[model samples]
Target: MTNSELAVKAVIDTWNQTIARFDSILDKLTDEQLENEVAPGKNRGVYILGHMVAVHDRLMPLLGFGPQSYPELDEVFLTSPDKAKATPPIATLRTQWKEVNANLAKYYAQLSADDWFGKHTAVTADDFAKEPHRNKFNVLVSRTNHLSYHFGQLILMK
Candidate 1:
């Protein structure tokens, strides 16, 4: 494989592994534990999980997968503070996490090497030509780090 193709594969692989790590961390928590705060004055595990769902849901549109499935979660977890809004149940968040990640996996798997190097959501085709570094592969790299960040927070509730 070309060096570029190998790089895309590596990014995709890292993202998949990060998702699995998130699942494993979450699986160890009881439904009751999901309500516990990461620390005093911090958000609960449930809120963090919901935040992930909301963020990944946003990624769908950005990645050309489809419209976001959980726009309602934006205010609850993304915009508002953790305690500012009522959080959804763990089961609901868990299902959303799975569905969104699964669909994203499908989307990422379908991209050709060229597609990975192509412009994604906002940057125009012209702009992309001028700045090839602003490609879709960067999105995966960024959000993989994002997932790992929150996954660490989720593990703290254990």
Candidate 2:
């Protein structure tokens, strides 16, 4: 395979691993545990879950997909900190997480290697021509890192 294809595959593998770890962590938590703070007086598990959902929801536009379905998630989970007016229940966020990840997986599975390397939502085509590294693949890499960071924090809830 080409080097670009190899790199893309590696990124997808890493992202899939991260998702598995996150789900494993979530699977062990009870609803009561999900309400507990990772650290005392800090963000709760529910807040973290909602925050991730909001962040991943934003990835759609960046990846050349349509807009997010959960704009309100931005205000409660993204703009504000935890205890932000009672984030969604664990069950609800879990449902959203599964659906969002499923849709994102479907979209990513359809992209050509070239499309993976192409400019994401923000950059103009001319700009992308100049700076090709700012692409959709990098977004997935960065988001994977973001998820891993939160996964560690969430794991502390148990």
**Predicted structure with the largest lDDT when compared to the true one:** 1
Candidate 2, superposed: residue stretches over 4 Å from native: none
In candidate 1, position 41 carries an lDDT of: 86
- Write model 1 residue lDDT over 1-158, tens digit each, in one string: 99989998888888888889889989989889988898888989999999999998898888777999999999999889888887777898999999999988888888898888777897888998899888888887888889989988888887
Error of 1 at 10 (Å): 1.2
**Model 1: CA > 4 A from native:** none
| Candidate 2 displacement at residue 53 in angstroms | 0.6
In the range 14-82, model 2's lDDT, one tens digit per residue, is 887888889888989998988888997988889989999999999988898888978888989988987
Give Cα distance to truth, residue 106, candidate 2, Å: 0.7
RMSD versus native structure for model 1: 1.1
lDDT for 29 in candidate 2 is: 92
> Each candidate's lDDT (Cα)?
0.88, 0.87
